[model samples]
Target: MSDLYEKLKRFQQNTPVQKPSPPALVPSSSTSKPLPDQLLKIPGIVRGSQVMEKIQQRDDAKKKFLSTLGVNEVTNPAGKYGYREIKISNRELPITKEDIGGLEIQTISRDASLAVFNANDFLFFDTETTGLAGGTGTTPFLIGIGFFDEDGFRVCQYMMRDYDEEAAVLHDLVKQIGRFPALASYNGKCFDAPILQARFLLNRLRFPITDMPHLDLLFAARRFWKKMLPSCSLSTVESRILGRTREEDISGELIPYVYFDFLRGIRIERMRPVLFHNVEDVVSLAMLAAKICRMVRHPENECRHGWEWFGLGCCLAAAGMWERTFFCLEQAVLEPSLSLEEWIAINKFLSLSYKRLARMKEAVDVWQRMIERGEDVFAMIELAKFHEHTEKKYAEALALTERAILQMRNRQNDVMANGPATVMYEELLHRWNRLLEKRKNP
Candidate 1:
């Protein structure tokens, strides 16, 4: 009877609950691609000297930081695991810091919002790591830096060759990177930067660089290509944006194992695909950044009226382009297929912008509509605050705050509830105390 009961409990535990489908990265809508100018053009990214100056500064910092660690070169010549050295380099490889500084980022967009670069300068970089792990233990044995200047976008990879060359590869990359102002990568913000930071920390080397801005194409791609695809991963974006695909590259999960095989002097063939994969990553970033820049610089020529406008608006706001955000939100609002999520976001942003523009009535109207969408937590919180401060409706604010609190409590998602609910809870106690004080005064 115990055995039977145990088997019955196990069966009950195997039941499936209805999973909440995650929010779509970008809602599907009108099938319009961005304008032709928004297509990636790599040559325009590497055009100027500010870019070069920033690069030099960073390179020196990294070199100074890393030299202290004493791991300066890849000391082995015999390929590991019996693997032979693969001659992946061609045309002497752009070896020096100066040579790489001159490549240009071709501006793909003529949109006004993306006019930061002089229609000419840009940087592109990618990395090949020891493994797929996110921890510091997983080092980038090879770091590739590519950029465009006068000549064009060039792909220069730091080939590990074996344990013997990893140090040399990193050192060379540090020097080369010191020549560009802006840097870019597919998923560099999350993966590349952390990996590089870890490698530098491990070696106790001063990473020679500061004041350089990174445009992670992964996040950018998500905003630009969200309408057409479910995801904005490099593989997906590269296919749609660049008209290129990597069917042949090794899966990222298989990469660390492949490096291990390389260390063991076996599976030299696997390295070829990895190299190709990084090449695609570097090239595609150049293309994608160029495209986004175009849309930013030439918003009037915008072909798609969805996430791109919203994205550019955010970018403009970052650059202190309030008018641009205003314009961007204006364009975003015009899109007929704007989802409930996007509509709320636009309204919130527009409300903020209107306040900045001293248009309180417009901002109030925006929040009122949001209040109507009481199911939307953000909207509810926003409207409650609006009522408290702008309308002087303290009671209305309290009611809205109570509703928000109840909604969060019902879901047991208290930890992430909107700020107003928490504020209201605390403030309620304060107000009660004040009432007691008033009665004593009377």
Candidate 2:
């Protein structure tokens, strides 16, 4: 053991120790900071100066665009971002109070009181949004409100130059919308109002339009023009109902792209058409509201076609005004332009309206007219019921029931072509048996 230990110690002492290799030699130039241009070449590295230059460019573009439109900057004391506003005088618009006067608000808004509010008491509003894909991400970049004052009609538009300015826009809209008692829009109840509410919630602000009486003209317009017009869009109503066609209006789908280009400091001039489109939309909204109000107030004088009378009758029927429904429907059936389908529909409603008002004679006359026009099973059934129960004419009731059964069988054959044909046949057979027993007993 001692000899083995001596040998190991001699081995350790004779071994030579090697020194550590020197560190890699970096060039002196590599130690210095890189130049701005050279650093920019590296991926994922943006120069601070370039960022500031782009921001300055965007600011300059915003200023130039706003200045050209005579927009005034609005400073909010409670918010960091500010918005821009521009007012259009009454002379610039093509509407007057006389055009929109005499509206019965209850006709359009069933909850509203009749004759309490007029055209001046309502505020007409519209919005231009970033996209139709409604969500938190979709923003309303522009808002337009039109109202009547002692002088005349005036339109106020609020615009945000950047996304940060949205809070300020909502802040000011709350104030502006508070002055009006009621609201009117083309489709505000579904689209604009909800979007505004969402924006208000996101901005931590109170929505002023909430709980305000809102009259969405889309419903009324559909009631009046659904059959007459190809579409009930605001643009179609403007051209067809209001007789105003836009010559240079920008397409709505292109508006968001234009706004994005403006934000990126590219072709700021394209925004001009978007602004024009918005202004025209607000103005057209006012005009269309006027037309709709006038039509509801004096449908006899305001309505130009039979379909309008039919629509008015339907509206009145929904409102539970049976007497007015009867009158409008009576007039609707007189026009020769009505198609066979429209004629049959109008007569059906007319008969029901008469029944609601207890004008049985008129109702019977309408049913008779429907029978004369076509083989109407509904009219035959109604007449059979009336004859059997009210007039005590069992023979006539049996005859009408037989006619209705035949009509139903023919319709089923025409439609389904060969089957047991149970469409209304059992009902008719039961009525026939009951009528036969009543006839024999009488």
Candidate 3:
């Protein structure tokens, strides 16, 4: 048994064990045969080479298109995904500092902080977005800003080449916006400003314009031209107010699609019109803001039409500028171009302005004129209150109240049908009874 064990150990010690070989290294390039045309045509099967080729083609097309628009690539340390900028010289645009100068921001915006800024301190801003359904999802692909410089009105457009570059665009845009003390935009308060604020919030950056004095020209445009123009959109105001029409422009509805197409690397030339449209919008914003401010400053000479006077009056009235409201309304009533409805509205506002200014005689005159025209129950009630409270003329108050009550009775069926009209009738009746008692006692 010992001899057998020694022989087995000697056999084990003398045997040579074989080591497993390492797996063979494959070449960097595959040598496998290409897939057949039929297999490659399957929905999910695409060659890596073909995918890369398409990406290269798209990148080439985008680069070529951006070059034609005179756009420059922007890089910063905060973000690697750089944005693009297109600078438009003052000579390329028709506007100048003289055109937009001499604006009273307080009168136009009614914000005293805005009063500190001159035309040069304002940034005329506009944005072209991915979609009108605004949210964080609605990205501003292009932002156009115009400002006055020693050279004149120069425009700078900041655009994101792709969705990933939005952070870079916002980073640069906040820097530019920080230079301006005031911001003016057409319909920006409702649309552009909110979307930009959301983008800044999502990018974890502070919105520079949040505390800036913002003058949304949309409200002022509506106040000045809503009655005179068919639509107070920037384009409409541009043609009607600025006396400039875009010879070549893209419709706002098609802008998003054009941007999407550009991003998809098709119809790159369509982006040119979008840039043009944005430039025009920025230019018109400055022009319209200037026009509004000038008209507000000198309504007597600037207002050419009756509706203009009425609009100015309404604006002044809203700001509680009773003296200016009276002057504008007085001029509006003198003009023959006002429609019947407009005339009645102006008269009502004129009377209110007169009352606000403590010009009771002018208020009485306006009420009498409205009454003489068609027995305006509103004017009658207003005059009755004035006579009762201010003058203590109980007989005159009773007469005016009675006339209003009679008018309501004459249209009793219509009055009773409307809830507000019924309430107004009850109020007139109450005034009539109170006035009668006062008249009898006096």
As a TM-score, model 3 comes out at 0.84
Please give, for residues 1-442, the per-residue lDDT of candidate 1 as tens digits: 9999999999889977778998867546756666553443334543344566775665454334333422132333322211111222334332222222211122222233323543134457777787766778777765656655444446665655455444555555566777665666777878888878776776666665445655556766665667657778777777765677677787777788887875554554566677667777776665666566557657777437667787777667765668767878778867888887777778788888787877777777777777676365565566666666677666666666666666656755563476766665565446445434534553
The alpha-carbon lDDT assigned to residue 84 of candidate 2 equals 37
The clash count for each model shown is: 59, 0, 0
Please provide, for model 3 over 1-442, each residue's C-alpha lDDT reduced to its tens digit, 9 standing for 90 to 100. Answer: 9999999999999999989999998686977656686577776666765888898889778877777777777787555332344455677755555544333556656676776667888898999999988888999999999887776677888888788788888877878888888899888988999999999899999888877788888887777778889998888888887899788898999999999988888888899889889888887887787777778877777899888888887777777787787788888888887777778888997887788778889889999999998689999999899989988999888989999999999998999799999999999888878877887887
Candidate ranking under lDDT, highest first, comes to: 3, 2, 1
Give each model a TM-score: 0.57, 0.84, 0.84
Q: Candidate 1 — which residues are off by over 4 angstroms?
A: 1-122, 134-136, 197-206, 210-213, 218-232, 240-243, 300-305, 364-442
Mark the regions of model 2 whose C-alpha exceeds 4 Å error after superposition. 1-46, 78-95, 98-103, 113-115, 318-323, 413-423
- For candidate 3, which ten residues in a row score worst on lDDT? 79-88
- Candidate 1 lands at a TM-score of 0.57
lDDT tens readout by residue for model 2, 1-442: 9999999999999999989999999787786666876888776576666888889988877777777876667778545332434455568666667766533557655654434677788888998899976777888998888888876667788888888888878877888888888888888998999898899998888888788888888888898889889999888888888888787788888888988888888888887777778778877877777776677778888888788898888877777877777778888889888888889988998888788778899999999989998878889999988999999999999999999887886677553653444646777898899888888898
What is the Cα-based lDDT of residue 434 in candidate 1? 47
lDDT of all predictions:
0.61, 0.80, 0.82
